[model samples]
Target: MNNYFNSNSVYIEEDFRCRFRMRRYVFERLLHDVQQVNPYFRQKLDRAGRPGFSPHQKVTVALRMMAYGSPADSMDETHGMSESTCLDTLQQFCDTIFQVHKDEYLRKPNQEDLNRLIRKAEDRGFPGMIGSLDCMHWDWKNCPNGWQGGFSGRSRKPTVVLEAVASYDTWIWHAFFGVLGSQNDITVLGRLPFFNNLMEGKAPQLHYYIKNRQYNMGYYLADDIYPKWATLVQAIPNPRNDTEKLFTLH
Candidate 1:
């Protein structure tokens, strides 16, 4: 008990919270959630008959590593786990979180979800708009030799693109990660699974009214680089009028 609890506050877990960068309650809740789905997260006795680290500690170290983008060895002081073990813990934690929440969290919109999105978007004066589509890059520190040149054209750094469609509330409805950085945004969009889902008629139907004009389809807010399409809404370039400026501003 003394080992896990701080000497100053036995009940509050002040030291734990400080090290984990989360409230004690949230840490415990995350541990409970993961324990239900992953056996690897469960605490166990070692082969030497010594008690191993608890599930919360493993998750805390992994979350800290990911949240801070720090190396595994950085957690040795607080987590007391070996660098190799920290990497394994992080891998297991990510896989378990995805397996448990993928159905509800990462899945595409359903009818009810679509309705909620439509309501939220309409309330923001953009009726029938689902989300903003954009691409972000993540640096690849260990990119392969053959791929490095291709991925490092402009930035001179190897990166992988992640395209996502995210709403005002930050709910991501579409995600296509791991596209090569060599491809432009248009090529990335063309090769993404989001378009394949649309082509296969797997996307949910959308209906909304814009300026009292009824529409049967929804659209996404994209930047100028995206191609002209029925489902894409781009801002007017160099607006010289109040209406166009206001439209672009909002």
Candidate 2:
């Protein structure tokens, strides 16, 4: 632990980032937050009155397991913990992080957020654009044999789909995960609840004008696979003229 975290540590910040998949300050902040909320991370004494694992050890083990996909038992020689204990620590760390940070980090956009996103999009030449919508597949390396057929798609591997809408700063305003990988972007959209509020007239209203053409609802920049809905703006697949080329470029 002292090798990277101590004041006179041997490794540099870059080395720490390479090992932890995050900067030292980020890890330290996360550690502080986790320690604040979860008492399980606090060090205690064993039955023989010997000092137990420190919060540092537990957090480091959890991070190593997550960032490197290291097995629970993989830390035995380094951290001197059992596989089951490592698994428990990892689960607790994840739950605590989510519980503590979910509100600010993972929340639906309010009116202010929508307005900011709209302003940014308008400055980029898209008057009513909110963000970009897309789907990606994440491999399920430990997928069950019985569920592999349902999860495997064109990639011929067990996977799940994640649909998200992200803006210029890469802030994900919307995320819908765990869709069958066999599904395409369109199919995933059909099942997404992202539009449910809009359909029910419960979503925030948006108004914008482009060259005297006014629009009431905000839209997303999607790919050609998505349907030609007013709320989605797709680029021209084959631009024929300068005007078309300019539209596609931006």
Query: Highest lDDT, which number?
Result: 2
In candidate 2, what residue range of length 10 has the lowest lDDT sum?
196-205
Clashes of each: 0, 0
Model 2 misses residue 178 by how many Å? Answer: 3.3
Model 2 residue runs over 4 Å out of place are: 180-182, 197-203
Local accuracy by lDDT, each model: 0.79, 0.86
Residue-pair clashes, model 1: 0
Off by over 4 Å in 1: 1-29, 47-50, 197-204
Candidate 2: tens digits of C-alpha lDDT, residues 66-146: 888899988999889999999999999999999998886688788898999989988888877888999998788999998
Q: Measured by TM-score, how close is model 2 to the native structure?
A: 0.85
Error of 1 at 21 (Å): 8.5
Compose the digit string of candidate 1's lDDT tens values, residues 1-250: 3444345555466766666677777777778889998888888999999989887678878888987787998778766898999999999999988887788778878888888888988898888887889988888898899988777646778888778899887778678875554445776887876676544543356776677788887888988888777778898889999999998999
